[model samples]
Every structure is written in C-alpha cells, then in structure tokens.
Target: MGLLIDGEWSTQWYDTKSTGGKFKRSAAAFRNWVTQDGSAGPSGEGGFEAESGRYHLYVSLACPWAHRTLIFRKLKDLTDHIDVTVVDAKMPDEHGWTIPEGADPVNNAETMWQVYVAAKSDYTGRVTVPVLWDKKRNTIVSNESAEIIRMFNSAFNDITGNTDDYYPEELHDEINEVNERVYHTVNNGVYKSGFATTQEAYDEAVTELFDSLEWLEDKLGKQKYLAGDQLTEADWRLFTTLVRFDPVYHGHFKCNIKRIADYPNISRLVHELVAVPNVKDTIDMDHIKTHYYWSHTSINPHRIVPKGPLIEF
Candidate 1:
C-alpha cells in the first residue's frame, strides 16, 4: 500500500475515488525478459542469459502473483538452480516488507523497497513482490509475475533438462484465450471486489468472479485441466487463486457467494493440484491471511486477521 516517488518511499494507498471507486491496477514498470540464449526477449534489453544459480527470487507467499512464479520454479525443477527469499507475514507500518530476525537472506535489506532502489536508484512505482533478481548482474530480471513465470517455464530448460513447455506453440491461442478470461474475472477479480469503493464496482466484480468460477467448475467437470487433458500453465495460474478462495477470498475479500468446496469439480481440481509434489509447500496460509487483512487498512480498519474456516486442502 506504499510506493516510491523519485526513489523516496512514501506510505500511500490507491486513490479509487479518481476512477469512480474502481481499483485500477497500474501496469508493471519492469518488463525485462530472460531468454534462453541471452538474446533480447519480448521486451527490454538482452544479455539476460539463463544460467543455474544466477537468479534469486523474492516473493511473498500471500501474493497469488508471486505464488505463480514459485510454482513454476518448482515445476521446472529449478529449485537448486535459483534461490528464493520470502518476506515476513506481517507488513508493519515502518517496514513494508521486512525480513524477520533470522529470516534475512539474499541482500538482507531492511525493506522490499530497498531491493527496488538497489536495482534502480531512481525507481518509482509500487514496490511489489515476486521480484526475479539476477545475482550475476546484481539487478532485477523482472518484477512482473506474468513474465517471470514465463521465464521460469522455459528459460532454464537446458540447466534443468526439463523441456515441459506449458506454453506450447500449438496451444498458444487456447492458453491466451483462457488466461484473458481468468486474469480479468478470477485472478484480478477478487482484488477488484475487495478493493472496490463503490457498490456498483463490487457488484460487477463479484458477479463476473462467480460467473467465471461457475464456468471453470463446468469445464473441470468435463476436462482434467484448463487447457484440455494435459496440465498446462492455465490450470496452475487458476490454481493459485482457487487455493486461496475458500481460505481467504471467501470471507476476507467478501467473495462468499459459494466456496470452492461447493463446486465439487473445482474443489477436487484444487486438491489434485495441491497434491503435486512441493506445490503445497509453496502455500503459507499464515502469510496469505496476514498480508491481505493487515496490509489493506482500507478494507479491514481493525486489521484483525481471521482464524477459522479451517480448510483441508
């Protein structure tokens, strides 16, 4: 809920009033890409070669965006190759995302914003997590989770020797189609509903969210995953949101029309995804709950994090 203005850290919240109560998320500023051959990726400059132990990831387990990158890191067998440092569960007023005692690793900076400053002296914008840090270059490879996951999906294939392409050439159209709908109505929809300043915005966001969930439920009833039978990136993308729905979004975000458990297909699909080795390890409900409730003072002024609704998955 804070941003850097001319490299100075300032505690600030989104001004939803300017957009008539709609929470408009700003586009990510860092658009660098990690290509297989150190060539220029889809955006940014080249020379970002894919090498083992060259990159380190900074993530908040609570963040679904960050969660995706962690999932890819494990699925791609890049755990030993790339290192990760997680922020503490609670984000205090003074330190936005600090490393608790004995938790500091990587750069051991006082705050996550410090990492941004380290990368770019005059960096400005929201200091978000899921930062892909390049140890070799001593800079960030990318802060945008979407692109970072893509990098994890295929960038270090030679090192890991895992060529499982989630974004296959033949399925690009299908994956893009699914990603577009899920990103708008489900992935970001929960945020829209939770951060909505107007009744109309909340209603619209909630409606689309449930509609997408229903569609997903029906789709899962027929197919095993989002993109046909094979498990693709779309399913994992949706899994991060679904895993958090019942535990956090249902009550915390006011997305309680129905829990994922109510939709048997989604519930089962979620459990299956969680069953994947190391996938469940990536989830930390403590961090997930603390980050959303404590961080968003606008939504929960009391800042009281919930404890009930024990989820089996």
Candidate 2:
C-alpha cells in the first residue's frame, strides 16, 4: 500500500495510471544469494555463507510470495536453523508493514521500511517481505522470495543435515519452464486482475489466469507434481497461489470465474501440499483475509472483512 522514497516512508497506492490500468510489480531490490561456501551463486556479491545462526527471515503470512519461502523453509527443514520475524497482518496505510517495537528482534524497527534503511540509508523502492537478512553482515542477503527459497533448499544443508533437493539438476529445465508460465499467469496474474483499473486490463489478466489454471490442471493430471514424480521448487512456488485461490484470490481478487475446487487436479495438488507435515501450519487464513480486505481500501472502501466463503483446505 506504500513505498519508500529515498529511505522515507510515503503512503501511496499502486499507480496503474502509468501502465494503462495494469498492475506492474517491481523487481526485488536486494538480490544477493546465500551460498554454502561464502561464494556467489547467480547474482550479487558473495561472502554470505550459510551458517546455522547467521541468518534471519522477515515475512508476512498474508503474502503469497513470502508464503513460498515459508514453505521451502518447512520442507527443507530450515526452521530451527533460520529464525523468523512475522509482521502484523493489518498493514496500515500510513506505515507499510507494521512490526511494532521489539517485534523484529534482529533489527528492532517499528516498520519494515526502517529495516531497509538500516541496510541502505538511501534505499528507494517497494518494501516487500520474505527478506533474508544476514546477521553476520548486518545486511539483507536477498529479498527475492524465489532466490531466498533456493538458499533454504540447499545452502544450509550441511548445518541442518537435511539434503532434500527441491531444485534437482535433471529437472531444472522443466521446473524453469513451469515456473515461467505460473509466475506470469497464475502467481502474479491474480494481482494483475485485482489491481487493474480498466476493464481491458482486468479482462486480459483474468483470461490468462484461467487459461494457465486449465493448463496446470491438465499438466497435473498426467504427472504426480509440476515437474515430474518428485515435488520440486516449481510445485512449492505455485502452491502458495493455489492454496490462496479460494480463500483470498477468488472473491477478493475477482478471480471468481471458477474456483480451485472446480479443477480437480489443481485442487488435489493444493490438498496434497497442505497435508505435508508442518505445511498447513504455515498458513493463517485470518491473517491472509484481513490483510487483503482491510488493507486494500481501493477495492473495499468499508474495510469490511468477509466472514463466509468457507474453504475446506
């Protein structure tokens, strides 16, 4: 709902006017990766070694992007190795993500923007969550949820003694292919549909969203997971969005042409993922609903959080 301009917090809604009523998401400002041996993996500088007590994660339960990192943490058995600070679900317009005093034990800041300022005094951009902070360096290792989950997948394997590889080398091509489609169409498609200010933008986004959903349904019908028989990073990435479909994206985001329940394969995948140990515990429906309905005053002026549309998964 707000962003940081030169390290200063300013309350402003998404400017769809510039994009012809389309909601264009900004790229993550921090892109440093955490590797096992303090060496660079893909982007940014190195020296961020994966140590047991060297990193802290900041997340919001409501955010699907952040949810992906949480899922990876649970699946990769990095819960005990990496600590976390979850921001409040009610993101006030004045302050982006309310942390309150002492909520973030790592930074001890009241708002998320302050944490960004801590890393870089003149930082400018949207203050998003699932920030992987390196306590040893006292700077953010990575704010990109995709890269952060990758770090959790393998970086801390030696420390935790859990070598579950979600992004297997053999499945890289297939996983990337599925991720590209899901990221543009389904993962970010709901946001594009809900935040569109014009009919054209809404129609275009929703059309692609459902089309991809149908494609996913057909894909899952043949294979056990998105990539193949083994559950890979692609499945977890899409899991966050599919799990939130009925609860938040359906009515709240106006992605109601068809519910996830209507797609048997997709619905089965959602349930199967949630049934994974500790996976269901990562989800907080109240937080998810409150954040979307109460925060987006542009969508619902009254800020009345709906009580119905009971979801089973």
Candidate 3:
C-alpha cells in the first residue's frame, strides 16, 4: 500500500482523487531475468545463470501474484533447488511487509523496504512481493510476478530435470490472448472494483469483472482448462484470483454481484485446481482472510472479521 521514496520509506496510500477514484497499480521496479545460461533472458542485464542455490524467492502467502510463483515452483519441482522465505500474513501498508525480528535467514531484514534498499539504495516504487533475489549478486532479479513465473517455467530445467512447459510453443498466441483478457478483466478487475472511491469507477470495474467471469464460466464449461483442454500458464494465472473470490473479494472487496460458487463451472474449476498436487498446500486461508480484512481498515473499521460463510467446494 505504501512505497519507497528515494530509498526512504514513507507510509502512504494510493491517492484515488487524481484518477477519479480509480486504483492504478504502479509498474514493478525490478525487471531482471534468470536464464539457463549467463545470457540475458528478456529485460535486464545478464550474468544471472541458472544455479540451484544462487537464488532465493521472497513471497507473501496473501498475495495472488506471489501465489503464482509459489505454484510454479512447486509444479516445476524446484523446491529443492530454490530457497524461499514467506513474510508474515498480517502486513499493513503503513509499516509495509515485514517478518519477525531475526526471523529471515537470507537478509534478516525486518521490512521489505530494507530488501529494496539492499538492491538499490535510492529505490523508489511500491515494495511488492514475489521478488526473486539472486543471493550471489546480493540484488533482486525481478519483482514482476509474471516474469518471475516465466523464469521458473524454464530457467532451471537443467538442474531440476523437469521439462514440462506451461507456456508451450503450439499455444503461445492463444495463451497470450487468454492471459491478457484474464489479467485485466478478472485478475486486476477485482482490485479496480474494490479500491474505487467513486460510484462510476466501481460500476465500470464490477461490470467488466463479472462479464469476464461469465466468459470464463462458458469457456471452462467446454474445455478442461483455459487455452483449450491442455493446462497452461493462463489457467494458473486466473486460478489464484478465483480461489480468493468468494473468501476475500466477494464481501471484503465489494465484488459481491456474484460469487464463484454461483457460477458452477468456475467453482468446479476452483476445486479441481485446488486438488492439483502441491496447489492446495500453497493456499493459506488464514493468511488470505487476515490480510484483506484486517489490513484494509477503510473497509472493516472495527477489524471485525466475519467467521461464517465458510469456503467449500
């Protein structure tokens, strides 16, 4: 919720006044990549080779984007190869993400802002999770979740010996198309709806969100997954958001026009995805519920988290 200003931490929320009450997310500051060789992968500089013990992943169990990287790591069988650290679930925007003092073994830094400070002394951006840190270089490889997951998909095939490709060659175009629509209308749409301060902005976001949901319901009704019958990265990208729909977004974020349970297709897919090996283990309901309800004091002033309406298949 807050961001670093010239390597200095500041407690601030997004000012929706300028955008007419619309929530606009800032782009991730770190964008380096880890390829099989020392060559550059896409954006940032090279020298980040695929090594088993050279990288460490920093994530929040509450964040959907961070969840995607966790799923990829588990699915690709990279758990033994990569080290990971999960931040505390009850993170507020004011102090930002932090672990207990002397808890983190990698950096032993309390706040995520300190991690950014380690990467760049004058860093200026929202300190988001799903940061892929190169332990050797002592800097973040990338904070962009999309790019991080892509790196996990193929970067360490040599070390892990799992060559299963989520982003396949035959389905690249279709995968990108599905990913684009889902990213905007469904993945980010919930935030746009919930974070809006004006009626017009909320209306626009909710309409698009449900419209995309209906489209997904129809699409999933026919195929076993998004991007045809084959499982792809597109499916996992949307899965994190859907799993959270009824539990968090429905009541907490004001995205209650319809729940995922209301749509039978999406609900079934949610169960199926959860049943996937290592996926259900990645989902932490306590983390998800606590972060959304307790952190957003604007929505739940008393911080009285509801106990009923249990999430089930």
Candidate 4:
C-alpha cells in the first residue's frame, strides 16, 4: 500500500484520481534472473549461479504473485536447496510488510523495505514480495515472481535433479499464449475490480473478470489443464488467483459477481490443484485472509478482518 521515493519509504495508497479512478499496478523494479552457469539473465546482471543453499527466498504468503514462486519452489523439489523467510500477514501503517520479531531470520530486519534498502541504498518503487536473494552475492537476484518461477522451473535443474518441466519445450507457445490472456483478464482483473475508485471502472473490471472466468470454465471443461492435458506453468499461475477468489476476493475485494464455486469447472480445477502433493502445504488461508483485509486501509478503514464463509471444498 506504500512505496519508496528516492530510497525513502513513504506511506501512500494508489492515487486513483489521476487515472480517472482506475487502479494501476506499478511494474516490478527488480528484474534480475538466476542462471545455471552464473551467466546474465534476460534483464539484469549475472554472477548468480545455481547452487544449493546459496539463495534465500523472501515472500508474502498472502500475495498471489509470491504464492506462484512458492508453488514452483515446492514442485521443483528446491525446498532442501533454497531457504525461505516469510513476512508477517498483516502489513499496517507506514511500516509496510514488517517481520514481527521472530518471523524474519535472514537479516532480522523489521520492515520488508529494509531488504530493498539492503539491496540498493537509493532504490525506489513499490516493495513487492517473492524476492530471490542470493546469499553469496548479498543482493537480490530477482523480485519478479513470474520470472523467478521460470528460473526455478529450469535454471537450477542440474543442482536439484528435479526436471519435471512445467514449461516444456513443446508446449512453450501454447503456455505463453494462455499465460498472457490469464495474466491480464483474470490474474490482474480481480485487483482492478476491487481497487477501482469509480463505479464505471469497477463495472468494467468485474465484467472482464467474469468473462475471463467463463472462458476458463469452458476451456477447463474440455482439457485437464490450461495449456493442455499436461499440467503446465500456466495452470499453476492461474490457480493462485482462482484459489483466492472465493475466500478473499469474493467478499473482501467486492469481486462477488459470482463465487468460484458457482463455476463448477473452475472450482473443480482449483480443488484438483490444491490436492496436488506439496501444493496444499503452500496455501496458508490465515495469511491470505489477514493480509488482504488488514493491509488495505483505503478499502477497509477500520481494518476489521472478516472470519466467515468457511471454505469446505
């Protein structure tokens, strides 16, 4: 809910007034990558080689973007190789995303912003999660979860020996295509609907969101997963959003045109994904509910967290 301006932390919500009441998300500032041979990744500098116990992941369990990387890390069997530090669920006031006392172990820092400041003295931008920190380099390898998951999918294959490719060579084109649509219309759509300041913007966002859901329902009805029969990265990417829809977004974010349960196919798909071996362990309902309700003061002024609609399926 806050941002860094010229490396200084400032508590400010999104200025929807400028965008005609439309909520616009800031692009992630850090886009570095981790490669097998310490070579340069797609965007940032290299020297981040694939080594066991050399990298630590910093994430918010509440964030869907961060959740994707956690799923990838678990699916890739990198749990033993890479370490993790999770921030507290409730991010309040000017102190955005602080690790309450014993929660953070890596730097023992109070705020998540400290990690950014540690990475670059004068960095500026929204401090988001799923930051891949290189222990040896003493810097963040990447803060972009989308790219971070890709790195986890393949970059450290040699070290981990878990080559169950989610983004396979043959299905790359299809997976990318699905990912593009899902990211825009569904993944980010819920946020657009929730944070919209104007009725027009909210209506537009909700329409697009449900439309995409209908499309997904149709697509999933035919195939087993998003990209096809083989469960691809695209499926997991969308799963995070879908899993949270009914529980948090539906009521908390006012995205209640219809629940995920209303769409039988989508609901079934989510349940299937959640049933996946290590996938269930990645989901923390307490974190998901608490973070969304408590973090956004603009949305919920009193910061009163809800405790109903107990999820059964």
Candidate 5:
C-alpha cells in the first residue's frame, strides 16, 4: 500500500489519477538471482550460489505472488534448505507490512520497509513480499516472484535431490505462451478491475478478466493442465488467483460475473491441484480474506471481514 522514497518510508496508496483511473503495477526493484554456481542470472549480478542455510525467504500468505514461491518451496523439497518469515496479514497505511519486534530473525526488522532499506539504503519502490535474501551477502537476491520460483525450480536440485521439473524443456514454449496471457488478463486483470476509479477502466478490466476465464475454462476442459499433460509453472501461477476468486475477488474485487465454481473445468483444476502434496497446506483462507478486506479501507470503510460464502477449496 506504500513505498520507500529515497530509503525513507512514505505512506501512499496507488495513484490512479494520472492513468485515467487505471492501476499500473510498478516493476520490482530487486532483480538479482540465486544460481547454482554463483553465475550471473538473466538480469542482475551473480555470486549468489545455492547453498543450504545461506538464504532466507520472506513472504505473506495473503499475497498470490508470495504464495507461488511458498508452493514452489514445498513442492521442490527445499523447505529444509530455505527458511521463511510470514508478515502480519493486515497491512496498514501508516506502517505498511508490520511484524512484531524481532520477529524476523535474520534482520530483526519490525517492518517490511525496513528490509528493503536494509538491502539498499536509498531504495525507492513498493515494499512487496517474497523477498529472497542471501544471508552471506547480506542483500536481497530477488524480489520478483516469477524469477524467484524459477530459481527454486532448479537452483537447489543437487542439495535437495528433488528434480521434479515444473518448467520442462519440451514445454517451455507452451508454458511461456500461457503465462503471458494469464499474467496480463487473469492474474493482474482482477487487480485492475478492483482498483479502477472510473467506469471505463473497470469495464475494460472486468471484460478481459472474464474473457480469459472463459478461455481457461475451455482449455482446461480438454487437457489435464495448462501446458499439455504435465503440470508446469503456468498452472501454479494461475492457481493462486483461482483459489482466491470466490473467497475474496468475487465480491470484494467486483469480479462477480462468474465464480470459479461456475466454471466446472476451472473448478476441477483447482480441486486437483489442492489435492497435490504440500499444496493445500500453503493456503490460508483467513489470512487471504483479512488482508483484502481490512487493508483496503477505500473499498470497505467499516473494515468488516465477511464470514459467509463457504469455499470448499
């Protein structure tokens, strides 16, 4: 809800006035990667080798992006290799993402903004979660969830000996294609719809969101997963959003045209994924609902968290 300005914390919400009521998500500030051999990653400097007890992950159970990294960690058997710290569910405007004093063992920081400041003294960006911190280097390896999950997919194969490939070599083209559409239309589209300040913006975002959902419904009806038979990174990325659809996005975000249950294909897909080992344990419905309803005071002024609409998943 807020960002750091020149290493100083400033409380501010998304400014949609300049974009004509559209929500434009900013790019992540930290982009370094943690490789197996300490080589440079796609975008940032290297020297972050994959080693046990060398890295710590920071996440929020409410956030979909942060949830992806957690799923990957559990699936890849890296739970023993990497540690995590979950921030408090409610993100206040005055203090952003707060944890109890000394809750973060690595940095001993009270707030998430302090973690970003610790990485770079003059950092300036949104204090987002799923931050991969390198303990030895004393800096963040990556804050981009997409890249962080990719690193988890392969970086620690030798250490953990779990080489289950989600992003396979043969399915890269198809997975990337599917991820491109889902990222813009479904993954981020719901956010665009909920945060829009104008009628035009809301209409455009919701229409695209449902269109993509219908497309997914048709695609999933035929195949077992997003990219052919194998479950890939694309499926996990979209899973986080679908799991949250009925619980929060449907009513709170005004994406109520059709719930995930209405689309049988999508519903089946969610159930199957939930049944996956270590996957269901990653979901926390109470945290998911509390963050969206209580944090966005503009959407719900009373901060009343809903109690009904029992979601099976």
Candidate 6:
C-alpha cells in the first residue's frame, strides 16, 4: 500500500483524495524487455537476452498481478529456467515486504524496496512485485506483470520446448479488447471499490465490477473461454481475480454483489484451471488471506484475519 519517494521509503497509503476517492494505480516504472535474441520486443531498452538460469522472479503470492507471472512460469514450463523468491506473506508496518528466513537470491537485498532501489537509486512509485530481475545485468528487466508473462509465454520456448501460446496472433485483437475491459471493470474494479474514499467512487466501481462479471458469466456460458475455444491469456488474466473473489474480495474487499460460486460458469472455469498440471501448485490460500487482512490497515484496522470461507478450489 506504500511507495518510495525519491528512493526513500514512506509508509503512506495511496492518496485517493485528489481523484475524489478513486484508487488509481501507478504505472510500472521498469519496462525493459527480454527477447530471444535480446532485440527489443515492444517497449523499453533491449539487451535482455533470454537465457536459462539468467533471470529470477520476485513475486507476492497474495498479489493478483504477481500471480500472473507465477502461473505463466508453470504453464510455460519455465519453472526451472527462471528461479523465483517469494516475499514474506506478512506486511508488518515496520517491514513492508521482507524475506523472513531465506536469502534474497537475486540481489541479496533484504526487502523488496531495496530490490527496487537496486534498479534505480531515486525510483518513485508503488513498490510492486512480479519483478523480473536479470542477474547477468544485475538490474531489473521489468516489473510489469503483463510484459513479464509475455516474456514467460514465448521468450524461453527454445529451452523449455513448451510452445503453448496464450496470446495467439489471430486472436490478439479480441483478446486485447477483452483484456482492456476486464482490467478496468473487474481485475482492478474490486480494489477501486474497497480502497475508495467516497460513496460515489465505490458505487461507480461496484456497478462496473458486477456488470463486467455478469458479462463474463454470459460470455463463458456461450464460449469455452473468454477469447474462444482456446484458453488464452484472457482467461488466465481474469482467473487470479476470480479465484480470490470469494475467499478474500467478497467480504474483505467489499465486492459483495455476488460470489464466483453464484456463477456456475466462473466456478467451473476456476476449478478447471486449478486442476491444471502446475496451476494448482501455484495457489497458496494462507498467503492470500494473510496479505490482505493483515496489510491494508485502512481497510481492516483490527488486523484480524477471518476464517470459515471454506472454498473448494
């Protein structure tokens, strides 16, 4: 919930006052790309050549954005090619994101912010996860989850031999269309509702949130997946949000219009994805619950984690 100001750590929560209680997320600062031949793919500086055992991932299991990279790593068989280090689930005020016991593995920095500062001495913005660090360069390649997953999707195909493309060329137009809608209305909508400081903001967010959810319900009912018969990036992108909706977001984040369990298609979609080979192994309920309830003191001041959701997935 906090960020770095000129590389100095500040415990300030997101400022929703200026936006009239709207919680607008900050754009990811590091946007370097990792290509097969180190050529620039879309944005940022190049030379991040894709190599086995050269890149490491930093993520929080609780974070949906970070969860995207974890799933892509498993699905694309980059689990061994790129090593990962999970941050401590607890977000104590004194320690924003720490490695409780193990070594930093990547840069040997104790906290996540230190890792960010390692990238840039005076970096400012939210200290987010799903950071793709290049050990060879000794700097962060990218912290943007979408791009990180794209790298994981194809960059290491030569080594992993798992050429399962989630973002296919033909469906790019439709998938991006669905992604834009889902990112605003659903993936980030729940946070907007909970973190909002104004009634108007919450109302607008919740309305869009459920509307998109219902649209998805109808979409899934008709088609096998969001983009089509093939399960593309669109489906996995929506999944991390739905998987946490009931267990945490429903009650914790005030996204209480309806649970995923209420929608048959979504629930089936969740269970189906969870049943995938390594996808289930990526889910850690304890980390998800602890991070939300324990952190975000503005939302849950008492810092008491709840029990008894009893989710099947």
Quality of model 2 by C-alpha lDDT:
0.92
**Candidate 3 runs further than 4 Å off:** none
The whole-model lDDT of each prediction reads: 0.88, 0.92, 0.90, 0.88, 0.93, 0.91
Candidate 6 residue runs with Cα over 4 Å from true position: none
Instruction: State the lDDT at 191 in candidate 4.
Output: 94
RMSD of each: 1.3, 0.8, 1.0, 1.1, 0.7, 0.9
Ranking by lDDT: 5, 2, 6, 3, 4, 1
Q: What is the C-alpha lDDT profile of model 1 across 1-313, one tens digit per residue?
A: 6888888998877888888888778888888889899999999999899988888898889889999999999999999998888888778765577766545466778688998999998998988888998887888889898899899889899889999898988888888899999999999999999889999999999999999999999998998888888888898999999888888899888999999889999888899999999999999888898888887776788999888679888
- Flag the better candidate by lDDT, 1 or 6: 6
C-alpha lDDT (0 to 100) for residue 292 of candidate 4: 90
Per-residue lDDT of model 5, residues 1-313, tens digit only: 8999999999878899999999989998889888889999898998999999899999999999999999999999999999999999998989899876666999999899999898999999899998999999899999999999999999999999999999999999999999999999999999999999999999999999999999999999899899988999999999999999998999999999999989999999899999999899999999999999999998988999999679876
Question: Could you give candidate 4's per-residue lDDT for residues 223-271 as a string of tens digits?
Answer: 9888889998999999999888988899877889899989888888888
* Residue 188 in model 6: lDDT: 93
Clashing pairs in 3: none
lDDT score for residue 239 of model 4: 94
How many steric clashes does model 6 contain?
0
Better of 2 and 5 by lDDT: 5
Instruction: Please provide the root mean square deviation of candidate 1 (C-alpha atoms, Å).
Output: 1.3
Instruction: Give the alpha carbon lDDT tens digit for every residue of 222-276 in model 2.
Output: 9999999999999999999987888889998999999999999998999999999
lDDT of 1: 0.88
Q: Model 6 — TM-score against the truth? A: 0.98
Candidate 5, superposed: residue stretches over 4 Å from native: none
| Residues 134-242 of candidate 6: C-alpha lDDT, one tens digit per residue | 9998899999998899999999999889999999999999999999999999999999998999999999999999999999999999998999899999999999999
Candidate 6, clashing residue pairs?
Answer: none
Worst 10 residues of 1 by lDDT: 99-108
